[model samples]
Target chain A: MRIYIYRRFERFWHWMQALLVMLLMLTGFEVHGSYTFFGYENAVHYHQIFAIAYLILVVFAIFWHLVTGEWRQYLPTLQNIRAQLDYYLFGIFRNAPHPTRKTALSKLNPLQRIVYFGFKVLVIPVMGLSGILYLFYRYPQQYETLPFGFVGIKSIAYWHTAGAFVLVAFLIAHLYLITTGTTIFSNLKAMITGYEEVTDHHPTSDSQKQEEVVI
Target chain B: MKRIFLGLLLLGIFAAILIPSLFKEPYRPPLLSQLREKYHKKASKSADHSKFLPLQKPFTRPQEVTEACISCHNQRHIEVMKSSHWNWERLEYVTGKGIRAIGKKNILNNFCIGIASNEAACNKCHIGFGFKDASFDFQNPLNVDCLSCHDLSNTYLKASGGAGMPDPSVNLNIVAQSVGRPTRNNCGTCHFFGGGGNNVKHGDLEMALFDTEREIDVHMGTDGVDLSCVDCHTAKNHQMLGKVYSLSSMNRDRVQCEQCHTDKPHQQTILNRHGIKVACQTCHIPTYAKVNPTKMEWDWSTAGNLKNGEPYEEKDSLGMVAYTSLKGTFTWARNVKPEYLWFNGTATHVLLGEPINPTQVVKINELFGSYRDPEAKIIPVKIHRAVQPYDKKYNYLVQPKTYSVTKGDSGFWNDFDWQKAIQAGMQHLGLPYSGDYGFVKTEMTWPINHMVAPKSQALSCVECHSRENSRLAALTDFYLPARDRNYWIDHIGKGLIIFTIIAVILHTLLRIYHSTKNQARRDV
Candidate 1:
């Protein structure tokens, strides 16, 4: 059976965010002088531009999540969490069944919920706030910057770079987890077409089975 | 609905970048009117002294002009006497005692040491007449030099050691008639040439200031504002507005940018906020000694070195005098980036009789301020380093007679005898100088406040925040990000991150082994 897992708005937000985040990391690391690709000045310029766009996307995505009642999909639970962890670790390698089923109401498994929840609630907010502060730290007007605040530029830069590394680590892990689906391309295809396949004899309700064709 | 939100966001981003321009064009009065008012006010206030019958005489002595000027302006001579230019002694308050009088006359500087035995050569910049020896009259009002401050003819040439009077060949009648308001040339004559020649003392101030472009100095640009010396430094009763490092006056509020500008001089709020702790000069004057090279290092120990039977000199790549047998060895540089420091108006001077530490480099004049001081701001400075003669036996810096070229004079340059020069200098100052002398390392600091570049040329954010070759690399008081790193914290953080990944991988391998056994049993 095939099931519609992600809405159009959700798919749009996901792909746009991924693209912007990649662009931000590229330009941001250049600004940090990690390895210069675009020159330092150009890197800073592009990073600021992408950051503003990412902020706009975040606001719209937040609104969409709230209106569609999709925020609950990330609400974590301990029930079957260990089973899910076992499935990812031991069960999948031994050709065992997945611990939890995917539905319109539950897009993420237990561990996914915890990781994504922390990213959205903690890491993303931290990155956004710190990036904003760094942008305006030397807000130049009439060729002079505003005096420094209580927090120095160094503190702001450290927090922003730390957040970026967290995001980078999450991205690497997210990439690896995509290949652990029913088929290597199954999760990727679902994100693109909004339809994910299930085993033929999977015990899904008639109403739940019919939900795949709605989109 | 989503499309509408995206459209609104795009509009907001555009507004964010565009709104600043609308508020940027600040309302400044037309520069034409400001210039006219400034020059007109200065020109109209001075009574035409040229028409006065008392001044129309062939003055043989420069003192006669002073005498004639004081005849009409009775209290002018009295006011001039109290100024640092005339007295060469400032009311020292940096130590907070306020009782001591300290100035160039008594301060032991790195460039030329002290003015004790070298008064004839040093006092070419002095503002009086016939101050040849200790018995020179300070109370005589006729000795006040009016022409040095108000020479409009620009032809008045003060012979280097001619006791504060212009050379006899320079017609005093013409000079007396041409006296008017002080221009840049009038003040820069001594200031730009201090420590010997142009670009010697203050790196930011040089002959380049006379007709430099806007890129060199925005305020004093020849093609732009063309401001004279009196424009910002408006004098009242012969006392100039700005304080000098040599004078060590704490009256910093006498003149500032606030005279013509508002506190909120920026269009952006953040820049205005930065204005509180960062001085205007910090950003504006990015580099000093832009056009002409300024002397940075002077090694007096190398003086009296001769290649053969005659004195020899060496030149650097830029043709600047590098070494000379007469004086010392010097190193010069142009477009030099100034060292940053925390400066709170006051500069501490090492007085003439102060004790010396031979083991360490002595600061001839130390500029004191720190990040913790509220009154202090980060400012740019030119650090002039040197090796000078000091009395090793007395544990004090020695003053050597430098430029008395007379046959019988005991000047070091006149006849290369350190003992005679030291004896002559000690006798003149009436201070004890032990016969033994040795070279001691010394440094002098001058705060850079001129040669302001345009706004576009100001330092960028990354200049001072980089890992290598950062402008503030030498600054150790506070840790700067990107430039400074805590190794332990970084290592520990990375170690935890690595440990987490390793633990995850190990736990998964163990789970796989257990699950394979269970699957094998189920299949059997």
Candidate 2:
């Protein structure tokens, strides 16, 4: 049976962020002198534009998550996380049952919760702060008055580039994980239509018991 | 959820519409035109120089004109005597070498070498009555030739070999009566023709700057603001506000563009930030030697060649002096792009009697700066290279007597004898010169600060930002984006990306194979 899981704002935020991040990477790598697609000046110009768009999307996403109490979906938990890892590594090939189930209230499995929480708390903040510093490092009026001194742009640029690589690797893995659901295109369609096909288990089953424990 | 999505959609729409307008180019004020208007009124002089009775008197000797000028302006002679123009040296605190008097008199250059024993010929540009030898008195105020820079009639010409005296053909009375503030013509007479010819020493400075279109130079162009040399090089107590690094070793007395155009002149903050590390001339002066060809290379080893025991000269296809027995073989070029270097307005010169490595190309004067120096900026320069004589045994540069008044003398220009010329030149300076002599390659750098092109012709960002033939490719001290990248990071980062993609493909294929097997078993 299909049930509505992703809200309208959640799907919108997800797709918008994906598009913006892809554009940032395309222009950012060109700016780094890695094979040029857009010219250097145009790349810098567009990179700044997309970066602002991404920041805006992030702000809206943060507000929506907090106001709707949807932030609890990503709270890290160690329960069944090892089973989820084993399921992806070997159990998926044997058609074994999933360690965790998806629902309207608890959308993220234990492993997904930990990964998303770490990304939100660590990676995004680093990329955002470093990107802002890179944009305004040469702003003359603010340069002298800044509390912290920067000898050069070398360290900031390296950190931003490293974060970009991490984001790209995460994207590759995320894209592959979407296909590991009940069907090849089930999760993709669920994100788009907000309806995921979940198995109807008995109310007092072990999975339900585990879901109660998680909640 | 639907209401929140709609709100975000509206916000995104507003941002998309408003962002472009926020970045629209702002109106930039015409600061340059306003500056021109302010300085344009100073052209009209208050006093009519021709009405002075002292200047009207017929002056026979150039010294008599100086005496006539000193009669009215009595204390002005003291300021003139103290200047580098009359003294030809200044007390400069050179780094690593305590206070030393350095100037054109002591400094050696690749072109025309030094003026040790050849003062009679080289002193043609000196603002003095008689600097024929080492015995020329520096204490005498009468010897200061005031008319060389003050003559407005353009008739006060210096004799070619008369030791800085006025030419006999010049009507000194007319020149003295017409004396006014120094114009481009006055400064160009000596500065534009430093190495015995127009634009020979300084590629960016030449006779073309006396009167040119705005395209050649925005400031000195007669059609434009028409600023005189003194407008920027403002003088106080007869000491000018600028010094060439060829003779100067200190960073003081600099004439900066920021004096008028503020450091943050650009409307865009991005462009203004470049001013910190890039000099104005680096972009404005795209090319030097715009109108006339400048000497690029001189080979003294080929100077002794003559046709039938008579000194002769050869001309290149462009009619430039290619070879002259009196001087040397020279290579000339026009519209040449300047090479860039980091400079902090300070330099170290290869002094006289200083030992040099004969095997390597020695820098006559080394410009001191680096990417790490906060005060340093990238500047455009014209490098004049030459192969000149040096003492082989002593491992030091030896001055040669290239010119002499007496015919068939031991000077290099007359008798063409290297041994005798070296001996005479060394004896004049009281420096020991080994009899053994050989030619050594040397380089002299002159900063190109003039012949500034219009704003439209300034260098674009791609010139230095691209990986292909970047202008700043030689300066590898710091990392510049688009032109530089860390090799290890790039390799490792790319490797991980490729590895992730391969693993994803392998895992997906394995899952697909297992699923097909399970589906077949369920159907059976």
lDDT of each: 0.77, 0.85
Per-residue CA lDDT of model 1 for B155-257, tens digit only, reads 8888878767677778888888888878888899988888888988899889988777777887787766677778888878878788666547463635676
Q: lDDT of candidate 2?
A: 0.85
For model 1, residues A104-179, the per-residue Cα lDDT tens digits are: 7688999999888998899999999998888777523333434565666667877787777777667766776786
lDDT of 1 at A4: 74
Error of 1 at A174 (Å): 1.7
Query: How much does candidate 1 score in TM-score?
Result: 0.85
Which residue runs does candidate 2 get wrong by more than 4 Å?
Answer: A77-99, A138-147, A179-184, A197-215, B1-25, B31-42, B312-319, B507-524
- List-wise, what DockQ does each model earn? 0.17, 0.42
lDDT of 2 by residue, B91-201 (tens): 998877778899988887888888888988889889898898889999899999989999989888998888899889999889888888888899999999999899999
- Best candidate according to lDDT: 2
Q: Which regions in candidate 1 have their CA more than 4 angstroms from the true location?
A: A37-69, A94-97, A128-153, A200-215, B1-47, B96-99, B246-277, B306-312, B486-524
